[model samples]
Target chain A: MMIRLHRSPSSSMARLIGQPDLCSVSNWTSRENQLHNRSSRATEQLVALCKWLEMRMTKLIAGTTISLDGFTADAKGSPAALYADFAELQQSEAMQHAYRTTGAVIMGRRSFDMAEDPDSYAEDYEFRTPLIIVTAKPPAKHPKEGNGVSIIFATSGVADAVRQAKQAAGDRDVTCVGGGMLIQSLLRESLVDELQIDIAPVILGSGLRLFENVDQRKLKLTSATSLAGGRTSLVYEPL
Target chain B: MMIRLHRSPSSSMARLIGQPDLCSVSNWTSRENQLHNRSSRATEQLVALCKWLEMRMTKLIAGTTISLDGFTADAKGSPAALYADFAELQQSEAMQHAYRTTGAVIMGRRSFDMAEDPDSYAEDYEFRTPLIIVTAKPPAKHPKEGNGVSIIFATSGVADAVRQAKQAAGDRDVTCVGGGMLIQSLLRESLVDELQIDIAPVILGSGLRLFENVDQRKLKLTSATSLAGGRTSLVYEPL
Candidate 1:
């Protein structure tokens, strides 16, 4: 069935979108006319422009890996020790890319708890950014302050935490770093903007999952990288 | 306002998930109980899993950058030109990851038209996989045949193409390499399984968009990576 899809920019929706003032009525008409022509070639170009404007509203970042069943760590703070070496993860191109764009980070109680260990969190997270811990309880002692880094406490609603983080970001990117608990909260509120995952070679037989329950939502992969140690990193933009 | 959330999984339509045996009522209850217990984590895990499964369903292998105004490409089939060096792009970790997991690829007619340059396609596509072109008209010629590469012609239907692709993939992964028109069809029919995209460095003054006139389906990034030339890669799993 050859459906005649009119690309009239002056159509009611286009008029609303174009706002006669924003796009000029004549400009809208020409744009819509192109759609009316049903040019497979032309339609592709137009759609791309609309999407670019929509994605500019916010920025979000996520990083985590859990059991196949989807747990971030075991009952204790132990995070199932999946990736062979943080050294390899640190050196990968994906890691470098993550560091370049992110200006702030949000962490869950559990992830923050693990991060307190100088051996793991301190040495592991060398990237300089303001870290916000989204938890019910504040850390016994903040690390960033002592180490010439900024560590802020955000123990409230996810939206509130994000607002605080964005304010701290000051036109920079933010990364949501956590296991399942914190990530779920941000996701439910739809605060996350970009997700980066490192696929470790091994899957724990039984442990916590990064995902367990939530209404389904779709996401698209924007980039991918495979490390030498059988680890693959993928980046996603929400669809 | 505490919304009295329903405790039963039946309402969420997850009652049938992971059910070991569908024949008995008692077992069903037990399965539901087990599933419920597993879901008791903080809401964060649920969101991640939702995003994960979401991307698993709809995302195809290829990605395209289109304008926000809703066009797939310009009148001449040029969606937008990527100025990033091809040599550097070829060596990027993200490209390498795509090569590693991808066993087959599919593209729509519009996307195929962009590949009109046989030499660039031949030189850039180093990974050996069966590339299937879905269109009404057959190609005028074949370039890289008999080197573990073959181009099959399909006149209609993405679902059928996927079935044929699975046969070709054998044990490897299959990807739908898209142009906007093909993606629209796939998204409408729900044939896509994964979406991987590399947001290029440049935004065209105007061009086609990745999604146009589609349902409000959601996707979550299972992984993300940043590349060398300000390029970012993301992978989405469909809900």
Candidate 2:
């Protein structure tokens, strides 16, 4: 008997089973059947498998573009210097992959307010998924939403915001963008799984640093690739 | 007629002449002779060539190993975390190149003091070159020196120290080894020609930062190579 599973859900199951290409549960079920020789044992194995899959379903990624000196934004809270090569970097393979895999976004209230036209993000932003704003209080008026973009004001806390975002993301990844405080909080709580930085070839002597007050965490370099216009993309995973 | 120049001296001469591989001065003199066709003019050209070679003979390089988050040392002034991959990175091609090209070293007093046994550097340190110590006052007793390593105390200022170091380096490069203040002063004076960083895969939340208070400068990425043990070697030249 063969059991078909959703590709994303089964991908995590495959990873858990050490067979990354196993897209269906049929092979594992057959093996379990052969080993147990009983229906009850098979049912228990399937339940355990589902629990494992649920645990590894969603990944939280903190991503940003920073200057060579590690500043995410200039003193005036402007990221203009860091985004000089944005047009070119936006077309990079890693960025395209992020766009394709991002199922939801979590941002701080300041980042949401920084957007000139929040409603425009619904149509123009690359990650047209849901947006969860972590704030102490919800805004007086909500922005218009369409094109699969819905805003949720999470007034609870960072952990709760992450929970809501993960639930919304389902089997895809939840990406945290903007506000170093938010990322630092996530890093402190061990909620962030990946950290992605695109280092631009400029030095900002004074600015808002990306890693300020971040909890100490050892990272393993997963990838380092030179991008367009002298930018470098470095991806790290917590070890 | 062929005019042979020392390989290191002529390397810079070739760079100045826009012919990087023209090790011998014959090609350039021959072309000048054809253009001028006068003995007196040839003498003037030779004098001008000597001055140009003098100006471009030595390059000042600032090199260090830093954590992924840009910390050079831990809170207690220990670089243990940053040098975790030092053994592997030291054998990398970029490190070997730096070792081969460096003709002298400049370090701050604190960095020199941090050495448990300063005399041992004469025999063990990779750069086995003359060490220039920039301090407010010279130490009461000098450390023992041998094997082409001599210590010089420069109390005048960073500029005078650089000038003396460049004179000692001759046609080879002068590498600034430690202390952020020394590097920052050199940077403020626009004395640094190259910046080389070996980025280790660790994060130290609190430590000495490398680029703190550095002047704003644009850099051109000369090279970015992944070295042994997940360390990255990034070389940059100020634009």
Candidate 3:
């Protein structure tokens, strides 16, 4: 039987299914009708599908690492004061992959201090990613505009800050770049959704820890990637 | 000037000091001299003391709030889940303060089915006070026994189950408690440190909430309190 078409020939769906002689057109029309029927019949199911995709799409995480001891700073309050250098780890392919995939970076006041040039780091970061400085202090007036980053001094709350950052990132990722204090603060607030740690080969016998004074909780390793140079990267999705 | 050596014959220190002054005590004379010096220093410091007193400590926080959208379930499965039930919040508080002060409680598998729990919550919950749970499914299982209340179940991953439940309970108090997944798998992986929650006021609309498929990184209130009525409660925590 010929399938009657509603639209013009330019509508490929209409022309392809309107031919009278070909069983191909008949089968195509039937399939289209079946799809339409199913969509209408299972509206709830379709909504669920949309929701599932939306959740997956809208999902974003800020990943960072700190020492086991939970100290993002040293006794003098320098974030880089605690650890040896991360030069080797930073140069790895995994680090590059993470940087490329992430749309933006989330940082706290203490973490921001570690960047050699807070302003320049925010401005000319190699990745060209957006920078979000999560701080309780009021934002300083930008010395100039289009520094390639927008500084947000989030005093109101962490959740609110993340929400704003996520929106800014659109459909990309947010990487939490720093040591323990900011991460710990976020952890204390339950704001960080995922944690990815690159366990370096050497351990500092005594220095600022990654999670000092942090509440006790559990972390499950969702993915573990072992790098060539005795380095291991672990990805954990909060339970 | 040489201080007068005299025994009041009252206090232990005076008596001992005088004995050391005696020549017959020469065998242990050095020890007695050391004791006498220490006693004299104590007396001098006591007399020099300006003030001595005890004080209670209270850390100040800006404030926090956690709201349960109709996502969590009650015993029944319903969309209109309990957002804030003051009664439940009180129960959670009581569970922490009365039952377990220093230990942990477990959560179940179905409890945290949405998102993974973050480490931020865990560090906050477990630093001084610890909670723990067990589970096998999406939501984490609540931990029972040891040093806290029993388990509640939410089927989820090991790390998140422990992290979220702990963070949901902020500074007020908490103990580790989760259902099957948290305990069975997370516990084995050592992700959970404690469990605590603040039940809220109002009844759930209907359904198996409290543990459902939630976002892996969602957290509501950190603290909750019981109200005048036995049934109503409030759960609020910084997000």
Candidate 4:
């Protein structure tokens, strides 16, 4: 028999498992509630199945533009040189795919702070999704939230931040925007599902490298495309 | 009136400028020698013109396979991981072009030493051309060279080695087959004309980076191609 899920199975499973309300599943019908109460053993089995499906559906992708030499930013944490081809990179097919698939973003505090005005992201950012900022402490005042964008401060750790972001993402992807340190931590923990690297045609002799201190991993190239303005987009997944 | 050069103008120009016999220009016709003896002033002008043409024609290309994270070799100076896509990389159009156009090679001593047997290069290496090894001192014994391959030890330093390689290359390109240190030195001196990087799908985490300690330079992407076995070939020239 075919089972029709009115809401995302994972969301319903989370509610039945007594997890925090990570997603909105409040519109459950009386029939579904009756079914949930019918068999505890069957519900547990369904929870395991949904959890497996959720793990497969929600991906965490680390996406960033780096220099030819693999640096994400210059010594002073500026990515000015690396973004010369930003306009073209933004128009690339891979980037468009990232934008369409991303439902949440996780970034380090430094990356968030690098923005001249965090409030601008509410309306101007490409991914108008929930933004989870990982930091040791949340700031005193939060940015004004609107346009379906919410700023969340995760002080627990990167792992917790990833969990929250994945929940917010639902079936979509959680993209890790960077300051190098954040991406490195995620890579070290093997939390990243895919790496979308746009290699700019500039060499920064000394800078903040993207892969510094990350665990060694063998990656299989998924796609390589030449973008406009001499930018190459390379997609890889850990093997 | 059109002036045709029977021999390479640079060869004739080098002789006119009283430089070392860098190339074999002995096949100069008597008429050409009479022209070389005819006017010192005209010969001086031709030397300057040929020098400009030579500078424009002969390019120095630094080519190597690097990991996605920019490491040319692992900590032990082994590129085993990087060469996983070598068979396809060698068949790539860019690599084929490199092979077709390269007439001489310059390498560091460490790279030379890495070869189990130096004499095997004559039979096994792709480029059956002159090999110039840059070192502080030449070895007491020389490898048995044949099959149009001659090994020269350049105790005079990298710059002098480059000069010798370029002279030997004649109208073709001089390629630097490296260990990272040699490529870095060439980059520091702004001598590399093109960077032919074959990015393999791997992250070394810690290793010898290809662009380490080099001068910061802006490059324009010439071409980016995806090769067999998930390898990416990117060609760049300094802007």
TM-score: the better of candidates 2 and 3: 2
State each model's CA lDDT, in order. 0.56, 0.79, 0.43, 0.81
Q: For residues B61-145, what per-residue lDDT tens digits would candidate 2 score against the true structure?
A: 9988888778888898899887777677678777788788887899999998887887777777777788999999998888878
If ranked by DockQ, best first, what sequence of candidates would result?
A: 4, 2, 1, 3
Q: How far off is each candidate at the interface, as Cα RMSD in Å?
A: 14.6, 0.9, 20.0, 0.8
Which structure is stronger by TM-score: 1 or 3?
1
Fnat of every candidate, listed in order: 0.04, 0.75, 0.00, 0.90
lDDT of 3 by residue, A8-86 (tens): 2132333333333432434467778787657555654554454333323433454554322122443455445223436
Enumerate the candidates' DockQ scores in order.
Answer: 0.03, 0.58, 0.01, 0.69
DockQ, candidate 4, comes to 0.69
Of the native A-B interface contacts, what share survives in model 4?
0.90
TM (chain A), candidate 3 = 0.64
Local accuracy of candidate 1 as per-residue lDDT tens digits, A98-168: 77867677777666676446334444466677778787877576553534247777887777887777666
Candidate 1 structure, TM-score to reference: 0.39
| Strongest candidate by DockQ | 4
lDDT of 1 by residue, B103-122 (tens): 67787766666665754554
lDDT of 4 by residue, A1-239 (tens): 11223335565665667443354547878886676556556666777777657755688889888999988888877899988877776787767888898889999999898878888888788878999999998888888788878999999998899989988887677999886899889888888888889898899888888888875689889988887888888999877
TM-score of each: 0.39, 0.81, 0.37, 0.82
Alpha carbon lDDT of residue B14, candidate 3?
Answer: 31
> Which segments of model 3 are wrong by more than 4 Å?
A1-62, A67-85, A143-148, B1-239
Error in Å for residue B27 of model 3? 72
Interface RMSD of 1: 14.6
